[model samples]
Target: MQELEEILRAHAARYPAMEAADYVKLIYQNEFGGCPAAARDGEKERAVPPAGGPLCEPIGGGLCRVHLAALPQGAGPALDRLALATAREAAGSRERFLQKLELLRGLCAAGQLPLDSAALEAFLAQGGAAGPCPPHSGAYQAAYAPGYRVLRQSYADMLPAFLEAERVAARGGVLALDGRCASGKSTLAELIGRVYGCPVFHLDDYFLPPELRTPERFAQPGGNVHYERFEQEILRPFTGGGEVVFRAFDCHAMAMRPPVTVPTAPFAVAEGCYALHPSLRGYYAGAVFLTHTPEKQRQRLMARSPKMLERFEKEWIPLEERYFSACGVEQFCGVTVDTTDLF
Candidate 1:
């Protein structure tokens, strides 16, 4: 609708260089009823319309609802092929809707079809009539190709940075790599450690013991695994020029594993999903944020692990958005590596 486009355009203007895909994700989350794909048996069909004002029911069901309105014109067949591919890739009755979305994006980019609501609806209807299906070769190949390139290029381009950081560390400077989940933080961390010959410590090791991992605090909106004991036992000791034993957290066991003494090595690499927490900012000499376009992030996640795509989109992404808004680290990052350039 004209109103939706106007709103998105206004919002995009506020954030320099924000892409159409990012706007699409934002609109899909805020203005639409967010849900996973509907069941193939039509058990989850429901009339969903655009939010904020009255709009026509472009499509019914979960996946179709958000995507139908977002796609451009004449992209129906490609969307259908993408849906079938997603259904086949995801086992059981549950569907990996985001995977299909990535596939549709590839089709749109490749000029295989024009994007539009009619095309999306028609594709869904056709898929429904065809019953259960198998994955499409084109869809799978196209969807994952770019992601593979991204991963490969990120690792490759990161080598020089890792070496530079290592050289700095050898001269007594600390390097900090920070980013949201699946933003290639860990891979970069590992690469940095290898290049610098430094010990790598993952913050996941410092989480509270499993028995204490109650849903009480973590279950709340904006809740995070913040354990004071972790700060005292792990973070303080290491950063204060003292040797501390490192114990990895066992999520399944809900306890810390046997403690392993990690000698205080110069140029230690402390990396995790939350490595750039404000509390630890002052200790790093240099920092880098691996920034990825939301579309690329979604595509990479779907390619690596289809099941995680749903959780990332529905739960993790909102939390991450909140975290970045609160921390405002984007403004302070010394270096930013745009993953798109590498891909």
Candidate 2:
């Protein structure tokens, strides 16, 4: 294990702020893998301890493969979404193995790490297996009480929303997520709710009905949504700390569903297009505006039906843009995330 020691030593030099205990945790993860977690999207995720401080911070956007395995099996839909997204963002284990191998080669080339790289490759080539955790694994488990399961995710795209959620939760206030269609507002909102244990309220549920689609209403920027009902139902009761009861407008059925009651929590999330409209933006303690390049936006939209993409390109996207430009949605919000490159 001399090579392992050399790897640790080099990692310590690169990330001096990492404590000994964290190193042990990282080694444990490297050897035995992370704890199992599941996401609402049916992806299996793994959670790892936050390994290093700022200099070598493991959070943020990258091609690196990592995951959050700490979230419990039944941590609710919001958290499950986060776990799913986290898993989707992570590179596959095989990819991670290649990345580590490349990293080792790079370190050795730079004279920063000393080890028999060829020997490591030979061991893997010879079908050497890592573990079902040997008996001594209990010692490390004992040292790091409560086991290796802790909820921490390292996706780069999640940092801003995560921090904003923490800030809003500290004040027991609401956070808003507004963005271009398919810009990942809902996904990020779910991640924030999972991390902060907050309730999420989607603007999609308050969609406008056929009866309200008057030309005058369509002409007004940000009038596409049933904001009047939102202000009366979600907004009023939410600010008052009472149960929020409102019927979701079903776009498919073109009608309102049965009344849904949501319990008020210390923090809550409001996410979707038009969520940061001028009338509602003021009520939020914090807000995140998600955006991406036109090319990336279209790429994401490819997942939907061609007719739907046509409608978005012709009708809905333009409407949302007008509102965003008219209301300065990005300027009003405290954070803006350009998700063009991030998953």
Candidate 3:
């Protein structure tokens, strides 16, 4: 633990974004190289699983045998102490027990313990209620919330169009990122902004006020958003290179919040449902429409905001369908992307 602390203190600048658990992994890997060099690529993959044996494809980065326990510690550290408690009981005899001991000692001969301790400390610090479980018991996703899990995906498909738009919109222009609900449009837009060096506008911020949610208004395609206000305050000014200040409608408070003045930028990503609406179409330099299966969208909506499902089914989904179909939003976009193609 002291050695781990020393390294953390010495190299803290190197791993500015690395969490405590990741540091522990470096120690463990340096010491054990858990998945041996030769075992990594083909030999293990070629071996067939025994009939009826269970198989699991772990996502994200691979874990070591120590982390195989699925300790809430994550990819942090795999220590001998944990192994002793976890594995010593399974050893059939003294020789087997000594062999496991030797393995641990040999692996920890350097400074792998750093990985082990930092991970544990971070886990405890994060309010993870640690508990003991039998070895080989499955690691549960319920151990953490979905928000804690990172969504990784390639920008290869969207990059070309995005870069082209950035070039075209060098002075200023709108890139409309429209998509199916819960299809990750917002996250994708943010990623685009990071790479393209632009700002992102979430049209969700201009949701229709309670007063505007009348039956007749709801009947109109894409009538849910207060697009009139959005266009005047956000779309128009941003696309036209004017001084811009806009207020985000507070859904919970059912009122408009204070306005924020946006600085001028080379490009802007307008992301959300109805971002490419017929009324706002001319404001965009380019648009990307994201698609997803209804089942997958429902699954995401259920996990993301369970309470919104009833409203989405009864009102929002139908409204979006009418809007997308009548306006030909999918066809209108310059690029079409499937959510499954990414993470």
Rank order (by TM-score, best first):
2, 3, 1
How far residue 8's Cα lies from its native spot in candidate 1, in Å, is: 48
What's the TM-score of every candidate structure?
0.49, 0.65, 0.55
lDDT of each: 0.50, 0.63, 0.56
TM-score-best of 2 and 3: 2
Clashing pairs counted in every model: 7, 7, 1
Compose the digit string of candidate 3's lDDT tens values, residues 1-343: 3343344444333323434333333333223332222222111212332223222211212222221222223211112222222222232243432343344333334444333444454553663312121111012112211111111113333433444455456546888888788877887787676655677889899899988989998887888899999899988887777768999999999988998998877678889998987899998888888888888888888988999899998878888889999889999987777875444
Best by TM-score: 2
Extract clashing residue pairs from model 3: 24-115
lDDT per residue as tens, model 1, 1-343: 3444344444434333333333333333222222125212121123222234222211212122222333334333333333333333323222333444444445445544334444444554555213332222233223321110001222235533544464447566456666666677777787666545677777666665555556785653324545455456656777777886767777778766898887776667666645666766677666777778888888888888998789989977776667666777666666677765444
The TM-score that candidate 2 achieves is 0.65
* Candidate 2 local lDDT, residue 43: 22
**Positional deviation of residue 38's Cα in model 1 after best superposition, in angstroms:** 61
Off by over 4 Å in 3: 1-152, 157-171
How do the residues 1-343 of candidate 2 rate in per-residue lDDT, one tens digit apiece?
3454464665556544443233433443343233234332222233333344221223212212222333334333433343344544444364444454455555545655443556445544644324211221233333322212212333344655665666677688789999999889888877676556678888999888888999999899999999988878887789888888989989999888999888877779988999887888667899988999999999889875665898899999999999999988889888888988776
lDDT of 1 at 328: 74
Model 3 poorest 10 in a row by lDDT: 144-153
Worst 10-residue stretch by lDDT in candidate 2?
55-64
